[model samples]
Target chain A: MPRLRIQIRDLSKTFREGGREVPAVSRVSLDILDKEFVALVGPSGCGKSTILNMIGGLIAPSAGQMLIDGAPVRDVPRQVGYVFQKDTVFPWRTVTRNIALGLEYRGVTGPEQGRRVGEAIRLAGLAGFEEAFPATLSGGMRQRVALMRTLIVEPEILLMDEPFGALDTHTKLNLHAELLALWEAKHQTVVFVTHDLSEAITLADRIVVLTRRPGRVKMIHEVKLPRPRDVIKLRESDEYAQQYSQIWHVLGEEFAGHAV
Target chain B: MSEKLKINFWRLAILVVGVGAWEWLTGIKAVSKIPGLYFIDPFFISRPSKIVERFFYLNSDEVRLTLWQMLLSTVESTIIGFLVGVSTGFAAGLVLGRNDRLARIFEPYIIAFNSLPRIALVPLVTMIFGFGLLAKVVLAWLIVFFIVFFNTFQGARGVDPDLIHSARFLGATEGQIMRTVIIPSALAWTFASLTPSISFALIGVVIGEFIGGESGGGIGYLIIASLGTLNSADMMVALIVLAITGIVMALGIKQVEMRLLRWRPEYQQR
Candidate 1:
């Protein structure tokens, strides 16, 4: 078995708005093994992103402990990377410069920086647009830049919060294919959060379903989909349909009483 | 005709008609004889031709050197004041924007100071700094600082929290985040404030000179001197030069803005 990459023990988060204490995530605990792809799915306002943020060390947990490689996470670990849902690519920086940002911050200069940034540009299929700014690029292209920026740093654990949630179905499928190809080569540990159940089934090794607001683990279903899988073709398979139905049965219950 | 050509034609037409009417009205002796119509007195609102003639006379060799000296003084004070104001305002804005405690402590005082009609302080500033370039510079600085400071402060404060989080995740130190993220984000606002700041700086300097009288040897002083001697034509000539200077300065700033902010969508080349 692969070594455990992340350990979450009774992790919880409560947010304060005005004078009231609103619970976002409650007593959520799960372990992620190295190179495992886990997807957290639930209705909107289910604290899916709050969980990802806590894992990435972007926010302090209100209670409970989160451990990465047996060490408590106090700040963003060097081996961890996070891809936000919003288009966080700096509009001021060009494709090359945006990809080079992390390396530049780490004081990696000279040809080494150029080589890495060039490789990232090629990886993201942003070759001819190397000098192009974010404003000039399409929404899908900009998100690719945002992804490549995080990927270039080569983090061991990649926490993504609905990274492709904003794209259209066509672009979304294309990105899913690209993402799977990249993951197949690197096999990095990934914890993805999404509202789309099909996306969870298509991408994850395991799917963790959570209840509506004040989110808790409702069920955890392991995906037995084989490796080197085709994101588009797999949706047509019976096994994929069965897994989707099973997860949806649990995920649908949470959204039954309200608009999703 | 093209839209731009049509617009320019109308603008020129308006200018001709306006100036032609002004010249005709001032030349009418009967209109001046009527007490109620004396508002357009030739001695006060001088005709366009006399104003143009006075402009040429000021630029003539006999008086050109003095005019040049006065123009240079005003330009120097305006430029110096603008630079000082922008730098100090930008620094203050960044610091206050980044520090909540500092902003909270100083916000009330800043708002109070900004609320005061800055023009009302011109005489007081001139009195303290005396009738010199220093007085004009100080007044210009006072007017420019708040314009730059407020815009920059808003810009710095309005940076997306996601960007800051992304920078931190990428292993950026606080100082690096400030330099790479916060400063660049605030720069758009800072640049937005610059055009107004420069105009206000010139206004402040001229107002300072107005209060300082002829002792402050600048374009403002020349205008005051013309006013004292009742040479309406010379005063109008000085006013035209100032207007031209303001336009030139605004154009220069536009060029710099376009160059610096080419990354912006509006400035991007197709």
Candidate 2:
């Protein structure tokens, strides 16, 4: 694949809690190829965000190496967009400036900056809201703004940490569809983290299920559903139930008390 | 232009009404004073005429180089002191806020120094700087330091962890993150703190003048001189002038804050 491939090997992270060692992410490895839309599905606090952070270079693995483009990941990738789990809008700037932020940091200025920001806003369905402040935007709109902000920089890879996790279920599903549409248009390698099985199943080209407490790659499901996927149509497919049930059965033990 | 003029007209009308009410009440002996309305008399304690006279004499070439010179002197001292104190405090606060270890080490020393009566050293400052510009400058700086330091420290530490993490995720270098997100975030807090910081500075400059005074002139010195000569009117006059100037300086900073911080939460309401 001409796209970026993230290879995680023996990665583990342990935090010192009350003079005792507690592991967040146990020895785990993952191989995501170029232009591959991969979903890391796990329950809340299952360290899905942690793994995304490790790949995004926001945190260091206590005991492992991550290879990107066949090279060791030491710092933030020069061409990767890391979307946060929450709205990342700077309150000081309007939606336009917020969207242009990554590009601005990448040294885009004047006409180029303005044009890129305009296109990003349009893509995010926020064209009429360029001058609107973040405080005024709805939760969904803000998340959309966050997405465009990262995507505008044209990174080869996109690492999103529960981008729409904070939104309502309806908003989350709608945004999932929106994101898939954008991804289909761009075909950028995306690693999305989420607790929602449907979101993972609907959006990912391949879904990697993670175990709870000292997170490890519990199982990997190849979402062989076809391109430009309609989430509704895909959900109704026989393969969807088969894969969802298989993964659910494996994760059902951990979902013990958190069945909801 | 018309809207603006209307607003100004309303402001001036309110000012006139206030003044007229005061003038009438005091003139008719509605208020009490030392030996009746004599002190309350606008013509005696801080007469408008006397302040106007002083205002016009701001640049006379006589022994007193006009009110302008004194004002300039006061302004120079105030600004220099404020900048020095603010910069130094910001630097120290940055160090302390980020490095809790360093803060723990020097915190006791800072508290001890800050708690001391800063005005008590006015006489000592006068002795060292010799009634010259340096003396006033030192006094001004002394007054400005603690406020700026404490506020900047709080501001620096109060930077949003979310913002910092966002910056790092966006591939912001440590320097860029500090310069763009953290500094601006802290600046909002710092400017808000500056409201009181500047008030303290006013006290600093005025106290310096009262304790000893600059080479020859200052509003503070004028107040003292008038008091020494039993000229309550002149003292009142100087007091009014100082009050007006102080209020104006504070308002000026506030206006700048408004323009600079249009994004602040306080303004987010309307």
RMSD to truth, every model: 2.2, 4.5
Candidate 2 per-residue lDDT, tens place, A170-219, comes to: 78777888888889888888999988888888899889888887788888
Specify the CAPRI tier of model 2.
acceptable
DockQ per model, Cα? 0.80, 0.47
- In model 1 chain A, the worst 10-residue window by lDDT is A251-260
> Model 2: clashing residue pairs?
B58-B67, B58-B68
lDDT of 2 by residue, B1-270 (tens): 699999999999998987776555545553444355552565445445555565555445753545656666677777777778778777777768777899999999999998889988888888788776667778878877777778878888988776787776676788878777877777776787666766677677777778665463677877787678776666765677777878888898888888778775577655
lDDT of 2 at A35: 89
- Which clashing pairs does model 1 show? none
Measured with C-alpha atoms, the lDDT of residue A177 in candidate 2 is 83
What's each prediction's TM-score?
0.96, 0.84
Per-model TM-score of chain A alone? 0.97, 0.93
